[model samples]
Target: MTSPGMSITQLLPDGKLIVLCGRADDASAWQDLLGPARCLAIALDDAPHEARPRTLRGASDHLAWQHHAIGGLDGSGWLAEPADAFDPDHTATLVLPDPLDPPDAGNRRRFGFRRPAWRLFEDKTMVDTLWDAAGVPRAPSIVGDGTADLSVLGAIVDQGTGVVCSCQPRGAGPSAGGDGIWWWREGPPPTTIPTAGPGTWRVRLMPLLEGVPVRLHGLALTTRIIPFPPMELVTLPRPGQGTFLCAGAVPLLDDAADLVTHTERIGVGLRERLGYRGGFSVDGILTPSGFQPTDFNARLTSAMEAAPSDRRVLLHAVNLLAREGNEPDTGAVEQLAEDLFTIGTSCTIFGAATHADDRASRTTSVRWDGDRLVPAPSGAADGRLLITPSPRGWLLTATLATARLPGGGRVGPRAPEIFRVSDEVLGTNFGHLVPPFDTRPSACLPKVALNPEPATR
Candidate 1:
């Protein structure tokens, strides 16, 4: 068991740490969060080739890079050059897996990675069952094989808008962020689904809940669960195109006490049922009928990744300790959650596909002018917009000056304008994207008790 006073460095294994990620910024960010320590950070992306410790570019397969890293410093292949730095007998290497990938089995040197069994919950088709067991209210959904008639299943759950079909990663690897999902209205069904691999895959059909998409993050400790504030998932749908873009996340304005309660219940259910420990998030749409969950992420989600560096680092340490069967100080964990709530600031980063291969990085001072983002002097700016390249495309990180935001309202509506500004000034290509609709809280739904008993399905 770790003491409450132990720092994040103390909780980690005593050895040379290796941080592996898909983005250069991610590698640098993780290195910063881990504090001043003896760490070797490696990024597997094409951009920012000059970063410290260097990056292994042209490696399209992030999982394969992780697998190579797990093989230790003595092995050959892509890691051989990087492996020449340290002697295997004298220097013990501890690896930090990519946030999206779980650590391989029998690797005792890996830290802060999700268990392989818990990774199963990330499949879109399997989350509804967990929601039911947790007593979290969700829209109707049905899972079927790839060849199953989606129209029939879509009719069963289709509201007025349409049904959402999310592909199941059965034999293939897990779906990338926001991939493998499509919105269908009336058509012959999707001919191609975005999955990690080819061949047949399962699908989960559910009603496309209309409202503001929000995600509630929670940390499950040994004794209890700590829920964080809700963030608006800035999802832009390309209507008739059957696809949606996950632009970024910002703090939600609506009161979400009931949603927080549901998050707590879900934490209990996950702990009791699956012995799940660490951070998890529930993605849902706040509709006219209340918050209806749509997806569950068992690993460290992007929202959590966007939190303040101090909070993120602490939570990561606590999560790693809890997952290793060690009890973290409950009171300290509660205090950390309360501190995050009191801060009430969110990290907003907009994503878009780009054709540029510059592999360069740029930061611009900007402020929100009405509904658009315009350049401003650094001292007078409301936020700083950073553009960086990733394996998929480019990422625009908007570090907002919270006090300067007018009304402190939701940032979802401004995503399209951000892309427009980027394309115009930065010479990047991000085509038209539709903004999300405002949320409508349900009047018929009753308030959820903060401390309700666990309910069975």
Candidate 2:
């Protein structure tokens, strides 16, 4: 859905179309309450955010160090600086990756803080408490400080399927995926808690549910939650050891009434109470009993990559706001979201390879900052998703529909024809392919163009 006052258009440069957001969402009510649009503009800057490590919750002035793992978005919508570091007039958006904890009354005064992100989303534990308070159905689990409680886990896993443990820290580190989530293979649970080893580690244990996983998502100030279909997790090992592939995630979320309404209420309630805004997610498992929420994320989620609405929702949120003296069309933004909902089913397939060497560049950078694909200084700042298609191989990063992924499965499926191939062997056919020549241009050979034509020799 678009902002009441904002619209998006495309322009072509060099024969490629570029998407641009024009006009702006009217923010008279927000302005009347908060004063100035700059207060909301703070979310767009990268400097202060990059200078420190930022995650969705439980941040404090005394404890803003970057953590052990980075999140899916590479760290957009985050900040490492203190609440007082940037004035409210300098805030990027209603969302902050490191907004002051909602309970921090002591620090609220530093910014005169009319509209700081009220942090209801401090952590999974905090959310669990809130869900209980709201009488929402949640999966049963235990949290430990990364000390494996084999007895507890074994008992829990034995009751149902198995247990999946998510590391309680945010931010990606070398070879750490989804902050290093681990699943207990089919076996007897361990007898004792494992050592914390080296870093700050904690784990949230959840019993594997029998139902499929689906995502309930929303963005901007609009509370219309869209339930998109669940994505199946696919994995192909790399040379080192990790589920790396032409990663596709069309994580499930579709407009299931029971889940959608609750998600909206929760999302809107959080925004209204905490003044927290921007992209937020609540993932649930679709069981025969009903939808049961198992996870909550207060920032742009990994599933956002699989959601088409994400780009527009983010763009609408960042659209121009009412200046100091202007009057806000109070209901315009709200009405637009309610009436103009238009995001189709989304499926995201990231990490397309344009060359065998492409994997090398991809492994080093955040998923968004691909070497040969992205526009210089990458980010969708101008309302465009990046795609640098080359003759060799093209990198595709998009919020498309479920139909797009899997290259559209077979029509008359007799056990379903496999479209994409994988290998039990890692690094079977991936590596650097450098030309034998010292390819750098110099005085000896300032310019060199190997013939486009194949040589007989």
Q: Which sections of candidate 1 miss by over 4 Å?
A: 1-6, 22-39, 44-74, 80-84, 90-93, 97-108, 186-199, 307-311, 335-347, 356-369, 372-384, 403-408, 437-457
RMSD of 2: 17.7
TM-score for each of the candidates: 0.80, 0.48
Per-residue lDDT tens digits for candidate 1, residues 272-333, read 88888887888878776567788887865666546565565566566677777675567777
Superposition TM-score, candidate 1 onto the true structure:
0.80
Question: How much is 426 displaced in model 2, in angstroms?
Answer: 12
Q: Residue 344 in candidate 2 has what lDDT?
A: 42
lDDT of 2 by residue, 62-100 (tens): 122222111111223233232234433322322222221
